[model samples]
Target: MEKITHISVELRDWIVNTMKTGASPEAIANAMIKKGFDPIFAYRTLLKLVNNTPVEVLAREQQPYIYEIPEIGQKGNIIATSDRDIKVLMRVEKPFILYLENLLSEEECDELIALSKNRLKPSRVVDTATGEIKTVPGRTSSGTYYRLSETPLVATIEKRIEELTNFPIENGEGLQVLHYKVGEEYKPHFDYYPASKINENTGGQRIATVLIYLNDVPQGGETIFPKAGVSITPKKGAAAFFHYGNSKGQVDRMSLHSSIPVLKGEKWVATKWLRQSEILERS
Candidate 1:
């Protein structure tokens, strides 16, 4: 990283005054650029100064709440909050990854794999241009998924959620086990629609999504969010948590995401969609 110039006392005073008047760092940097200082230099300088400054010194500061995974069936993990504005990443440690892999014994994995041969189903998708339903060709290789109802795995995951977020997950509306063989993939799409458009039977808008990768693919399956610049490879037993809504109750646009196409080996995963209200209430 390039070192930024030290912020002069004069510039510090300016930053304090500008911040007091509700100007963002970007705004201040733009102003400085118009005054002849290089925009990049001003932005970098401001970032270094602000990051070096104590939180108590800033007029506004966002204190992040840490969510640690407790010992569940024999292992613990930690997932730190990413950014305040964007609730993007919640990564797991390696040991926790191993623990999750162990959750399902090798025999269980083999049984699931065998069962998958008979359970493989094609994914149904819609065409945006022509308003027609279509199947993704060759994209449906060999994969199987089993829905979750009230399984022990579901209960364990729920317990972990309560420990991490202090939020209670009631009964899950639906659950699924997804298996991808060598070349299966699901394209990009958002999970929840606006409240005005959702059907009565589908219930309220989805609040969060928990995706747990069951078996790791030796090559090529990744969840990529093109717009957000995030790509996560499938890791056996690791989970990804993504929240869709903001404090203002609006869903983020950049959250539009997709699943990467599998390339060389099979992949297996479990998914759960959470809603804002009970299914009965929505009905």
Candidate 2:
């Protein structure tokens, strides 16, 4: 660990500005660590600054709502897959939303939950303007990623998702399993990378998201779309799919969503992000 006798006032100002722009407490702490500050000191410093900051100043910056919805080629109440027939219970156009039922079996859900139990770690969010992954206070859940086709079970699920979404499997990231305990939640945010943040070195903008609910929360833990004024309750074996990007390089701001705080039991979900291009080893 490195020792620092001086905590510069400039550092404080930087933290304040970053927070105002929606940087997470953990992201600030991470930036400090990269600057040679001890991890513990960086974390505590950010915590104190966050605690003292006003709510309005620390709030996430809101973007103007976008009205465009990407095309989903499949038409009908049911999305056919190689192995299962997924029923589309609901649809919303603006953000290209679909509420799917019977997307996963109880056995599959249990198996996924079991496989992820020991590997879960804190979930992270991508920096809005930097494309950097940061563990953030805004996302208060533990998660783990499973490589594509890592197991026979995962392979089957990935295949099903590919068929359901009509997306190339090669362009999709690995499966991400997330577990949110009581009181934990993910703040509202977009699935696609901001245009300002895109660069040749980075993976292309995210095209869509497939979020599967592995278990039912007896109380809260709904997936809320703030822009659309819609909330989908987490149901075991069901899933929510949404598209936020298209070929013209436009990203939908209406795709802003969050995981509502779990009020009773834990919430478990699996997420798959599809990109326009093949992302590096991981997404």
Q: What is the C-alpha lDDT of each candidate?
A: 0.50, 0.78
Please identify model 1 stretches exceeding 4 Å from their true place.
Answer: 1-117, 125-167, 199-202, 281-283
lDDT of 1: 0.50
Worst 10 residues of 2 by lDDT: 54-63
TM-scores for all candidates: the values are 0.53, 0.76
The top-ranked prediction according to TM-score is 2
lDDT of 2 at 72: 47
- Per-residue lDDT tens digits for candidate 1, residues 1-283, read 3434334332454354334323456756665565566667777766755676521233332222233232231222433222111122344331111112233334444554555567667654333222234454423534443344245545555555444443345433455567676656765565555433444455466655666677777788887666566677777655566655433444544445566777877787766666655555421
Q: Candidate 2, which segments miss by more than 4 Å at Cα?
A: 1-73, 130-132, 199-203, 280-283
lDDT of 2 at 150: 97
Candidate 1 residue pairs that clash: 145-177, 148-175, 188-258
Error of 2 at 57 (Å): 19
